[model samples]
Target: MYHAIAQDIIKSIMADEYTTKLPTEKVLMQRFDASRNTIRKAIDVVFRHGLLRRVQGSGNFIIKQPANSGTILNLSIGFDRAAMVEGGPLVSQVVTFDKVQADDRLAGQGNIAVGTELYRVIRLRYLKGTLYDLEESYFPRTVVPFLSTDSVQHSIFAFLREAYDIYGSTTENYVHQVRLNDERAALIGVPVGDKTMCLDAINYLANGDVFNFSQTFFVYPDLELYYHTENIDLQK
Candidate 1:
């Protein structure tokens, strides 16, 4: 009975444009002839779902509708490839940008010689104000002649595609689940030993030449990863 009344109250507020204080407990008690415990329980339900936010010395306000409970999509394989599709806002804050020597791991991923000059870029990504993932990317200097912090701030993929005409499509992708270490946890603002998703992807050009490589760690329990394949009929 409380749930039914709560739902009606929520619906009424959502439908109306006027912003007014919710009726006091006394009014609600009279309207529904409900006990104090029942009224409190109804309010508690909405509060836990983020549909209501309480202000100090003020009444509860409807800040937003209840958020969708489940995993958000964490699309990685280089931002360029991911940006091709349209959905939600994709924002990235550059953490580090510098040139570095291609170590064994970097060389193997980019298919380049050790000690080759490579551009390293690190970014933290968010979805609707919630921290979602952290990414570290490496690019061959030969492919991207020059890069600047300002240019990347706008959109790294846009800068690459328009200025250098360097674009990458995913050739291979690897994903796994692992516990976050102290360093990684600190970077993502999560507790140490928290479960996370590790993704490694090798991106190649239209000609099959490797262009970029990346490793991304996503805050799990909030994001989900998926892959889909479809068969096409060439002959019609």
Candidate 2:
């Protein structure tokens, strides 16, 4: 029910129905015939999609949609989904896809037991024919056994959800501003020593097992991190 409400709200936003601020909670509850909790949940769904922002004393405000900017949706579903939300198709060029047994280093990084089999995948992500990001991911074969080249070209998450009914529940990301090496630089069409936003993430399944470990480099200049607010102090 909340998902349906969220879709309606998104549709309305796209149609310029709510351009500045959303209606009050009481007004929304009356309008949708939903409970306050459900309306709030729907608002959270829109917030995660980068469409709405909450002001403390003010009501929910609409965020101006960026012009051809690749948005990083806070949901952490997949890059393909994020691109789809921004009205563009995300293209992937698979660089490496192979099976390997996890060593001590890999196990520690992925929080999986040693000797577990994992598929190592490296891909260059493009938006509208321009290189946008690079991703190197490791997926446990126990969680994802048969990944095809077509899945690698498209979306791994979609393949998992459709094939195995597996979905991403959470992601723990470590953000860093790092300099690109010679090889990484050339792949993403950046100069060596160029600073890039890199995220190392451990993606988990609903059962709480680590499904994937990925390192992604954002080479795009207009990358936005909308999840983080301006006033909140990030802990060290």
Index of the highest-lDDT prediction: 2
Lowest summed lDDT across 10 adjacent residues in model 2 is found at 75-84
Candidate 2 clashes between residue pairs 3 or more apart in a chain or in different chains: none
Q: After superposition, how far is residue 218 of candidate 1 from its true place, in Å?
A: 1.0
Which 10-residue span in candidate 1 carries the lowest summed lDDT?
77-86
lDDT of 1 by residue, 27-84 (tens): 7778889998888777654444334556657766764322463443423324343332
For model 2 the TM-score comes to: 0.68
